[model samples]
Target: MAGFDLVVRGGTVITASDRGRYDIGVQDGRIAALGLDLEPGTREIDAESLWVLPGGIDSHVHLDQPQPPGIVQADDFLTGTRAAAAGGNTTVMPFVAQIKGESLRQAVTAYHAKAAGKCYVDVSFHLIISDPTATVLGQELPALVHDGYTSFKVFMTYDDLVLNDRELLEVMEVARREQALMMVHAEGYDSIKFLTERLERSGKTAPYFHAESRPDIVEREATHRAISHGELLDTPLMIVHVSSRAAMEQIRWAQARGLKVYAETCPQYIALTAKDLEGLNMEGARYVCSPPPRDEDSQKAIWEGIEQGVFSTFSSDHAPYFYEGSEGKQNPKARTSFRWVPNGIPGVQTRLPILFSEGVSKGRISPETFVALTSTNHARMYGLYPRKGTIAIGADADLALWDPLREETITQSKMLHGSDYTPYEGMRVKGWPVTTIVRGQVVFADGELKGEPGFGQHLARELSPYAKPGRPS
Candidate 1:
């Protein structure tokens, strides 16, 4: 018999804090050894001239979400996880949204049904607490946290989902007491609503107005408010999808004061701008998303945040919606008003490639920082650390082999997502992941999928060390 189940040889293994040319030995889906030379195995892969990095962990994605009547999400667990795998992601975390009048447990059960036996990569869940009732906060939420649903998100905007200040405080108290991480979508709802109504009445209803209605000040103010709430409650909070320099400054201020205010920024903030929402007719609807992309100055600020460590994890926030379908971006009412347009773009399959080409290939960041932002930090923040986000012995053997010189012009036809279009279509990127392995199994290689839907498993997470209240400064 061979000495090991598998061996990957001759690749420059890159981790968040280390890099070296090494061979890896795998046994029973876990890394058994890493050294200059490993014992011969039953299977061997020659990884010469490639960069072997930890598989990405996209901790924020939307798959098979509950939508309004005329709106529909494009990808379910099968297609979403497949796209994630193609992009070199071995794990993804999508939301289980609790609707008003429903129990949080019920929402989780329903989401599990949707994801059962249909994923191509491992999955975890975050709870969207839309209805924080007495039972939820006093009982259900704590129980769920103990049961491994250790993080939950709350909205400060969206009319149907927003929580009042008292409600927000109640939720944060639970998070602090239970040591569960709290994530906030920080956009001022009343301010946006005020501007949106005025714009609609003035007939400024184009998709471009979507950006105008929710300007940087709204995000800035809401971010500051959220940070203050976390401070008051002595809780750690993560502000999601920050898109403006002003908002980033707020987070920096909190951090300087020794507050645990983590921040996240998506690819849209770096690659696109308000101008993308000005496409002629209804075409611009494709770029519509909450806290819409801002000006070039804002883009520069986002890049600075990444470099300066103001941002914690870089996520895709992939919310897939088709452009032409009636139930997607082009819903009948959406054509008439920006408010009705589905608020997202597809990017699960392109998130890492964009960062690799733009950030690492251009020397804006080193390969080590790339691994930290795309993989390691997410694992640390979401409680999956050494097990899923590194190449250490006894960890899951999840890896992505990259061709640092490969160039490709992105196109929807070349993508594996279920969406009809990609917002980054025609954009050129210099580096790409040529092979992806999950749990010691080669799942994607040479532009083909080698894994099946049921190969992915659901993960139960531990309470994140980074999220514990009163953590060291």
Candidate 2:
């Protein structure tokens, strides 16, 4: 047989369902062989004593997204994908949000332009349907889905983004017919508005009040309602960034009844709390994401959800905004009212490490389960399985070689992202990814970036099998 293009030797391979020591041979960016004593390749690495796993797929990142005047996200495609590669991810799916009056295609086109020649890891897009007009639901959406954009997210909160019940159902109906997955950001808009007005009427306008205004009940009620919509339409739904126990119970309730309800939780839900949003001098603004990190009890519930299989994927939900800049978390209006703070934190680079250290290293979860949450499940959920999310032959050589015993303290200076700060600073983590390979090439190795911008390719995805309208067990 002709010699392999590259080979990774003597590493313990862990996939979502399998684990063993093997030498992986790569040719033309695909796994060509997996066994002991593989033939020599043009290039080889001694991966002894390391845990070799599929590179992470952060399915919920925001890079160079359009924002209102005077507000901007920190990372564009180049820096964001570089950070993703450095952090052991081979694929990232950021959103392509439809502007209020613009066609979805226009948004997709503009987004593609922004990403062209500016990525270091593979990229895909998830559409955000903020304006599901009659024409959109009738023609544009179905066409987009058929063109390989098979999953789209809708919101139930945020003044400019929220879709009313009727509009949401229209979109869900299209999803049902098109066999596309529907992702929802479930939070009651009116309830938050009422609470915010009430709080501001009094003296409770601190950054901490951002948590109080949109309490768990807001998410719970909206989650239940969104699930009900899916149940009515017999469509599968994915609830994104679930934080509160109340919302989780709603998802659990739907799943018990054999509804096709999938859930996703983020790093914030497991690592931070609402109290983190109570910093002095508006410093709390850094942690001011929507469904803002709940209390310790809620944190426990999030972990429980992960252990019990209530969550199908763990994503970064990386919304990058600098804390000290006028366009970021500390924007002029945000200085006075928590309501004005951008609702997200930077985590695309830190997502895998945090989960590995807290869940796998601490024994809260097996490494196999960790792979399932951070890698395999994301691929399956987003229709990239077999191709992007496994260690088997014929899969892409998207790999992260880990030093399972390595320990490092988290700091913004060490991050490759464009953000000015990281919410995970000072966190000590075990088991870092020392090498990240994409498409048979080492993109990041030994703490140095090896991939150049534009090396990554855009992927056109198929419909997720999980999007089908039946319970999965």
Candidate 3:
């Protein structure tokens, strides 16, 4: 018998652009071959009829950061990656943020310490420039990019994190020079703040008001401004959590102009809506998030954007905040006033199955498109391509075996995220990961995590293609 580390037999292998039934052989933490069965191996897993694809890459997540008073994320690197693996994702890229008055280098160092050896799978970081000083804009940023910290998010919304036009230009110039990607949280801070104060005075103190305060106009306007800024800087940009039709139009308009503007839509944008927050009592607080989910009409626009290829990738935006639990804001029940309620939901453990059921089962997207949005595109845009998001010979042996026939009603308690409530609670989903492999090792299987907590590695990523600013050769 030929010696191999492991053999995944009887799987219908698939990638972002192709599919076939094959037996994949893995050895020394890499794919040795993926074709017909030719030899035996140490471990053989029967994946007959299952969807064996590249492990998902969740490009947007906030693993651990002190979001400060009223909102602390529940999952650290340990629990976050566990839930990610449970959801069939073998790689995740989270932000390492620099708060105002903090050093960029120091902040990155601190984040690495918090995440080291605690992750459940391979992970990387995208830095956030909350304070773009000269040192950060010059030496530190360039050095970090070369060291594999190639992408960063710059906010245009929150007072503590938002950057003005001048500041944004400076940040963009640095990103352009370093060939790094910039992801923006595009919401007009001044406009949204004006609406928030106005709504409070108008006696609209309900969870639903959170959506109204920063209506689609706010998101669209900021999307336009961010795209324009990138154009002026000749850099590429990605607008995260685009939740409305108007915002999609802005990105579409920019792309039509031949701008490298990318968009990402989350599961919340497709699965939930403003009506979810209309529920009575404190129950509605669960649906609250920054740039809140729009109504059913906007949901349709998001779905259309997916089919039409407006969104280059998909992510969980997995910002966990416990609802009525020890890890949550003290007053999780308070529905009104954005300050009192935390802005996030636990979905890292449920993103894939929801998309598979709603998109694939409904024929809105092909299984190949699913892999593209969930894996390949993410790796390509984020500079992790061919290594973490494909089924090639040299890439990491990260795989997700999906059982399409499986059925289950998702509940917060059933997931491993630290949150006590899921906005998706009671929703039924089909198709989920029966097994997840990282470095040829099965970490999630038979409804349980089969490995220890410290098996994950912190990946260093080169500058992303989108982050590399350019107009042409």
Candidate 4:
């Protein structure tokens, strides 16, 4: 009989806080040992000269869920998880959107149905509270939080989802009482509305104008305002998809004051520019994400934030939309106005490689920081730490073996996403994952998928790991 279920030998093991050459032993789907040499097992993968890091934990993604009329996401749970596994992610967290008329419980139930028996990687849910009614704020939300849905997002911009300051405070009160983390999409709706109306009046409605409509000031103001709300309630707040330097300064200011304000920035902010949204004609529509990409200066600031430890985590914010068909990015409703265009791009599979190439390989960020931003910090902040984000004895055997010198151009045809386009199409990146292991199972190897749907289990999270005595102080 084999001494262990599997053994990964002779790789440079890297983690957020440690690094060394070690061998790993897996048994019963958990890491059973880590040492200089391990007993042989039934299965052995010789990882000589490879970088063995924890499989990525993408804390932000958007799988099958409700969307506005005339818009449909290109990927559902199964396809999304396949894309995740291809990119070396062993776990993903998407949102469960609570529509205005539905109870939070109903939304969770529907989301569960959509994800059941369909994921190739582990998944979790983050509540999108569009209707925090009295009953929900009073009972359903608290109960749900206690039952393991410990994080939820609130919007401050979209008309259908935006909450007024009073409503924001009410929701914050619920989060505080329930010990849940509140994530904010911080961009002032009125500011965008005002600029949008002005742009329309001037007939400046192209995709490029989309950037003008929501400049850095809008994000800066809202980020500052969100921090104030968090401070007022004495609750920890996370600002998501932070894209501008001005907004980053707001987060830094709050952190300097010893407030529990955390921030996340995405690949688009670092790798893309406003020019991508200025492509001639409708081509620019592909890059129309909210809090749009900024200038090189902002990109520099984003990198600085990462290096300086101002940002706690990084995510793809993988909101995928196909580029063709009536339901895709070029939908008829969006042809005439930038306001009508769906705001997102396909990215989940390319996030790690792009960051590894542009950030780590180029010496912009250290390997340890890469692991911290892409894996460990997300796991810790979202309450999946030891189990999902680390490679140690007793941790889930989720690992990614990397060929650091591998290079390739990112093209849509090579990607596994259901979407027909990638914002990174034609871009070259280095350091591809040669094999991805999830729970001691090889889900992806040498560019081939070897896993099936329903192999993923849902994670029921605990309270924010950052929460502590006088947490906001």
lDDT of 4 by residue, 82-121 (tens): 9999998999999999888789998999999999999989
Error of 1 at 276 (Å): 0.4
lDDT of every model, 2 decimals: 0.93, 0.93, 0.86, 0.90
Off by over 4 Å in 3: 325-336
Worst 10 residues of 2 by lDDT: 464-473
* 242-274 per-residue lDDT for model 2 (tens digits): 999999999998888889999999999999998
- After TM-score superposition, the amount by which residue 352's alpha carbon in candidate 3 deviates from its true location, in angstroms, is 0.7
lDDT of 3 by residue, 1-473 (tens): 65778999989888988999999999998999878974888998999979898999999988888776656788999899999999999998889889998888899999989988788888989999999988888788888888988889999988789899999999988888888888999999999888888988988877778788879999999999998888988989889988999999999888887888999999999999888888776567788887788888899999989999999888989888876753463364454465466678778888888899999888899999999999999999988887889999988899999998888899876798877777888999888889999999999998898967778887788667666555743
Which parts of model 2 are misplaced by more than 4 Å?
470-473
Off by over 4 Å in 4: 469-473
lDDT of 1 at 208: 92
Ranking by lDDT: 1, 2, 4, 3
Model 3 Cα displacement at 301 (Å)? 0.9
TM-score computed on alpha carbons, candidate 2:
0.98
- Over 1-473, each residue of candidate 1 has an lDDT whose tens digit, in order, gives 78888899999999999999999999999999999878898999898889999999999999999999978899999999999999999999999999999999999999999999899899999999999999999889999999999999999999789998999999999999999999999999999999999999999999999999999999999999999889988999999999999999999989989999999999999999999999999889999998899999999999999999999899999999999979999899987889989899999999999999999999999999999999999999999988999999999999999999999999998788889999998999999999999999988998999999989999999999878889445
* Candidate 4 collision pairs: none
Query: How close to the true structure is residue 320 of candidate 1, measured as C-alpha lDDT?
Result: 94
